[model samples]
Each structure stands twice: as structure tokens, then as C-alpha cells.
Target: MSQHQILNPADHAQLRIHTEAGAEFGDNVMASLAMPAEFREVQAHYPIVFRRDAETGKLAALALFGFEAGENLFLNGSTWEARYRPMAHAVQPFLIGRAAEEGAPPQVHVDMGHARVSATGEGMRVFDDTGTATPYLEAVANMLGDLDYSWHESDAFFTALETYELVEPFSLEVTLDNGSVQTLVGFQTIHEERLSALDGDALAALMAEGHLARIYMVLASLAQFGGLVARKNRRIALG
Candidate 1:
């Protein structure tokens, strides 16, 4: 469970954010819900796929990092292997929170129990001694704000995919070095066949909505699965 508290310099003047790679943050499975907005950045390194939320059963986009649950193959010591980290995962321990005043506006909140929080001098400072936000803190605020806005756009993007019936189940079968076969399920991907068959008007509409490129990006990201499988194999070899 998360203990989210509305971030305030008064209550968190001494808070410090972790500056090292996010690999130590104990987040193996990262949800890639920032499609359309973050598709290009995420696609450059991670395999963009789709999954449904266990609690809400809501379909969402995701960037795969491991073959199994609770495993992050990109975790190379304290640093993640990817050149570009998903914005959804890059900003850790902070999230959009409901404002204390009713209907005022959403505010940024920090997880009190997050391992990244510390009172020490190392890492980025959340606030100055006089209880003012530092540059790093300001950047985090901007990121959170941007994410809040982009998430709405991403929602519409996914809705368009659903409307066009482009969502389809995807399965991957990989053979490990020891000749053991593994089947991955419970995931989905964009239907390229349907996309390729769309009429010019529909394709133009998708282009107008800025979703066509992202849909193609999602399709292209599947190629990274070969890398993911190799990574999983490397981990197994290490063991």
C-alpha cells in the first residue's frame, strides 16, 4: 500500500530524492500508461505492450522489462540498462494527489514509505533549509504536471484504438539455452493487420489525432522482444 501525503515544504523541508539509478527502487514491473505522449521515448528502449490492471481490469499500455513478474532484467547493479527510461517510471515516489481543498486542484504527493526518501545530504534535495523548493524539486513538479495532462491524451489515444478494434491478444514463446520453453500470456498488443487494412479516411483521422505514428511505434517496439529474451537468458545464465 502507498502512504501518499500532499507534498509541502513545511512538512518535508529535509526530504531528499534518490539520484542513483531507479533500479534500487524495488519496482520490477512498470506500467506504461503514457502512450502517444511517451510512446517514442519508451519505444526506443523497452518493448511496448499492453496489459490490464488487476484491480480495475482496465486495459493499459506497458513496457516489458522481465519475462516473469517481480523481475527487472534491466537492473544492472544500481543503474538500469536502457538509455531512455519511461517517464512513468523515471519520476518515482511522487504522484499526482487530490488537493486538500475540495475541487481546488490536484497537488503533488510523495510516498512516505518510499525507499528513496531520506534526510541525508546525498541525492537531490527536495527543499532548501529555508523551506523553499529547489530546482530539482521544481523539475519534479513540472514532470508531474506534464504527466497529468498527457495522461488525458493517452486515455483518448487508447479509446481510439478500442473504437477501431485494434486491440488484440499477443503471446510469445521463447526457448531458453537449456532447451526449456516458456510461454508468456495475459498481454495484448496493437493489431497491425487491422491497422494496415484501414481506409484512407480512417487513416487520415488517426493521423489528425496524432495516434497513427504512436500505433506504428507500438508495433515496431515488438521487435525489442528479442532483446528482452536475450536479457532474460543472460540472467538465467548468471544464476
Candidate 2:
């Protein structure tokens, strides 16, 4: 039911985007895609993990928000209780698109059916009365550009991880204060043992390509799981 179209000032002049954080805008998710460039910021708030595409067998990074599907521990009513949100979630309702012609520049595409897309003049405007892009739109465009570039960078980072054999399956079992247990499965994390086993040359290669810091960031992010669990327990206690 998504209505996607190339964004234009004339067609979407009156369009406004709801900027609030809430589940009604599809923010109730357990995880969001993470990129290497943003791993530092993401690691401070969420645990970074990897998931493989079943069809393509491609590995992609994810920032965990909760232990279960559609349950975002960061979401507290209309507010997201985090200092940063992943670009995958922040960009909502907007995406980069390409034209049919070869070598065409990327274009901004909007999902008209998205919950954030509104025409009631109740949200941030996409365009001004003079048919020019608004500040909000400009900021979104910059974010889209960063997301597009980081997406390709993530591919290289994953490829490097595979080459170094640094990835391994990970699982966790969390027991709440109320004695309920939740098990997280089907995610992957860096193999510290293998990573330590690598020779100096391999380590240099990773560092040269800027993947070493990100790898450590991912490792550091695992500690955030305790904070996530605390949030979950607090939510449970409140209810």
C-alpha cells in the first residue's frame, strides 16, 4: 500500500512531514540497520549486531532496540529515549531513487502513503510558498546523501569481516526481574578469538581500510545490552 513517487516541488508543495517519534509512524521496531560510519554514535545507545539476508546471504549490521519484534525499548510514548537514532529510522518516508537512464543522478522519492506524510499543514513543510525547498527538506536531503554513501561503505566493511573470518553467530538469554526469560537468536557478532589470532599484516589491512575501529565499536556496543534490559525491566515495572 505504499505510494512512492519522485518528489517535486510542484507536486508536493503543500506536503508536510510529521517529525514526532512514535510507533504510529512505524518506529516500533526491535532493530534498525546500522552502518560503519555511524557505529560510534550507535554503539553508545544500542547493541550492534549482524544479520544475514536469507535470499542473498549478504550480511548487514543492525542496532538492537529490544528483545522482541515490534518492541522498541527506546520508544516511550511519542518520544524515543535515545540520544541518537539510526539513519535507517531517521530517514523514514523518504528514500533515494534513480531514473531509468544510465548514469543518472539519484533523486529523492517520497512514500505518500507513509504515516509521516501529511497534507493537513500540521507538520514540517517540505516546500515554501515560492516553490523552493525548505530547511527541513534540505536537512533530509543531506541525511539521504549520507545514508546512500554509508550504505555502500557498509558492503565493503562486511566484505572485510568475511575475508578476515571475524564474524560468528551470537545468542543471548535475558531474565527479567519478574522471572520471565527472553532469548535472542539468529544474530551475529565479531569473533574476538579469531580477531586476536590474525597476523599483524591482516590487522594492518583492517586498520588501513578503517574497519578496525568500527569492529571495536561493535564489540563495545555489546555492553549496551545491559542498559537495554534495564529499560525493558523498567517498562515492565511501570505496567
Candidate 3:
């Protein structure tokens, strides 16, 4: 279990956070949550897709990594080979906590057991001896702020897609060079047919909400799948 505690400089003055990128850092995944605000960056490296939340059944956007689970294509050696790493993936060990009272600001909490953290000062210090935030901590705080804002913005975009019936299930079947087949399923993407069916008024609403561009980004990002499949092929070949 995660031993999460409120991040206070007094109690965590010695806290250090690891900045390494690798499987040891727990970035192994086929996908990570993506925000509409991040589509421009995410589309450049990863395929953006949507899936239904297992609990809420609402459409959720993600930056795809590989064709299967627990396989992140961007990982090479100990580095993440990408120009842009999603904020959802960049912010680790620290989580945003809701305020105990309504209207209060959210609090930052750190997972003491997270592999990225070290108490022996092996990594970047979160605070100096004077209990002041370090540059690393400041960056994390900024990232968290962006993540919080993106969550709301992305949620609104998904709601708009749902209202217009523009989200639908997607399937992929790829034949690798070795003749093996990789069939990907249970994912969702923007439905071009339904999206095209939108009336002028509905189209105007989506455009006004800034959802139009993000939707096209998701569609365009699918081109990166060829690279993802190639990465998988390399891994298999090396093994």
C-alpha cells in the first residue's frame, strides 16, 4: 500500500525525488491519461485514443504507448525517447488531494513508498534545509497545477463528444513483418461518420468550445501507431 502523507516542508525537508526515466520508475504502460489541452504535444509522439471508464463508462482520452498492456514504446535503455512526456506520466509519487472543507484549495500529497522517492538524499531534494521549496519541487507543483486544469478541460471535451455521439469503439488489426497478427480492441476513438453528421449548429458549438482541434489531433495521432508497432517488433527481434 502507498504511504501517502500531506507534503509539508517541515516533515519532508529531507525528501528527495528521483528523476530517472525507466521501467524501474514505473512508466510501463500501454497508455496514460491525456487531456485535450495536451493533444498538440501528445499527438507529436503518441497515438491519442479514448476508452470507456470501467466504472463511469464515460469516454476517457489516453496517449497510447503499445499494442498490448505493460509495454511502453518510448522506453529505450534508461531514457524515455520522446520529445514530450505526458504530464500524467511525468508527475509521479505526488498526487493532488481534495480539501477537507469545500472551496478550500487542493493539497499536495507524496507517497513515501514510491520508488521515485529516497530519504537518504540520493535524488533531487524537494526542499532545502531551510524548509523552502527547491527548483524540482517547484516544477512538480507547476506540473500538478497544469494537470488539474487539464483534467477539467479534457472532461468538458469528452462530454461534448458524448452529447454529439462523436465517440465510438475502435479496432485495429496489424500484421507484423514476421506474419504474426496483433489485434487491438476495447478502445474508442472519434467517430468520423458521426462527427461528419453534426449539424452546423453542433459544429459551431464544438468549435466554440475548442474541441474541434483536439478531436482532429486524436485522429491524426493514429499515424504514430506504425512507429509503436515497429518498436514492438524491435523488442521481439532483440529477445
Candidate 4:
């Protein structure tokens, strides 16, 4: 039987956001997008939530979906003892600990206090009093669907990707200046592996001899060489 190729958008969405910049996107959104999917399956059960600022009434940040487990309550990492709390806050009670004392809470807050890049080519760095540092700027230029050299014009995008590792099907929901959220999906590939396979001692010499092109080209070439894998229910086959 010939192998059948199946493209599942959900599978690519479930990757972890270990990077500080990525965590700002929120757990609910990431989990919803990242969970692996079977053919003909519906969307994820949980809804991506955005937190509102008490003072401003604006959608300030995202949520990590911390809920009470029982007599013993559980947040993301820290554990809390359950108590008789008000009905309104019973589901996600506020913990009284170092994180709460610092007013950071269990959720990853984004906006003025986190990494931000301006459309006008300006950048800023933000730090919380609790020693959390965020570098604000367009660190990378990510092109989805197909690889193109035209994106190399942007300084921040170019500089960031120059030495960065490529992770496939990168999903991100960016909050725009007007408080609108935009979702981006993309892929990544690295040059280190390809360069290491070559017989070279000098790193500079490798680049001078067109190593970058070879790396990126190899990634695309995988499609031609049947490196792409097709998956269906109970089966994974080469495409």
C-alpha cells in the first residue's frame, strides 16, 4: 500500500514554551494549539483565556489555567492547602506565598513589563522588581510556508535567526498595540548540524564556503528525499 501523508495542525501547536519569551504567550493557548490530533478530530476542549487588568479593564495578559484539585490545591508548580474560600474564587484561589507576595501570581504576564518590539524599529528592555528580565525587540524574522531571502532585510529578524535554532511549526499569539491578538505559525531548522558534518576546522571558513545555504537547502531537500513523514490513526509512514 502506498503511504498516505496527513498534515495535522494541532500536533505542531503543543510544543513547550521553555523560552521566557515564549512563556508570555500563555499555557492555555499553547496547549490548545500543540496537542497532537487524530484524523477527523475536533478542536481542543479547553479555551484560551486572556486576563483582564482590574484597573484598566483591558486584556492585559494570558492565563496558565490553574485550578483546585481538592483538599490539596495545585497551581502550576507550587502546592497550596485548600481552605474554605468564597464561592467566586474557589476554583482558582489565590495562593499566599513568595509568588503571591511578590504579586507575580501563577500566570505569565505580558505587556509593558515584558519583551516588546515596536513597528518603528525601536526597542526596550523591561525588568520586574523580582529580578525577572525581559528583552524587548523583534529578535527574529520567521517566514512561514516557504523559505525566502526577501525577509533578510529586517535587521532584528535577520540577526536573531543568524545563529538561532529552527523549531518546526512554531505557534505564537502576539498581542498587537491596539490590544488585538494575532496568531502566527511557522517552522525552524538549524545550521549547526549540517556544518558539523562537514570537514572543517574554522567556523568562518565554513560560512565563506556557503555553509548556510547548504543547511537551509538540506531542510527543503528533505521533502524531495522522502524525509517527510505521513501519519494517520495507528500508523506513521514516509511521505
Best by TM-score: 2
Better of 1 and 3 by lDDT: 3
Q: Give the alpha-carbon lDDT of every model.
A: 0.81, 0.94, 0.87, 0.25
C-alpha lDDT of candidate 3 relative to the true structure: 0.87
Which candidate achieves the best lDDT against the true structure? 2
RMSD of each: 1.9, 0.8, 1.2, 22.4
TM-score of each: 0.92, 0.98, 0.96, 0.17
Q: Tens digits of per-residue lDDT for model 1 on 29-89?
A: 6344545688888888788888877898667888887777777788877877888777677
lDDT of 2 by residue, 1-239 (tens): 79999999979989999999989888999999998999999999999999989999999999999999999999999999998999988998999999999999999999999998876778899899999999999999999999999998788899999998899998999899999998999999999999999999999999999999999999999999999999999999999
Distance (Å) between predicted and true CA of 84, model 4?
46
Candidate 2 differs from the real structure by a C-alpha RMSD in angstroms, to one decimal, of 0.8
1-239 per-residue lDDT for model 3 (tens digits):
59999999888978888888878778788888888899999999999988897998888788988888888888886888898988888898998888789899988889888888876668899999889899888999999999998987777888898888888788999888778999889998889998898889999888998989888999999999988899888888887
Q: lDDT at 33 for candidate 3?
A: 87
| Model 3 ranges off by over 4 Å | none
Model 3 root mean square deviation, Cα atoms: 1.2
- By lDDT, the candidates rank as 2, 3, 1, 4
Query: Per-prediction count of colliding residue pairs?
Result: 0, 0, 0, 7
- Clashing residue pairs for model 3: none
The residue ranges of model 4 lying beyond 4 angstroms of the native Cα positions read 1-128, 131-216, 223-227, 232-239
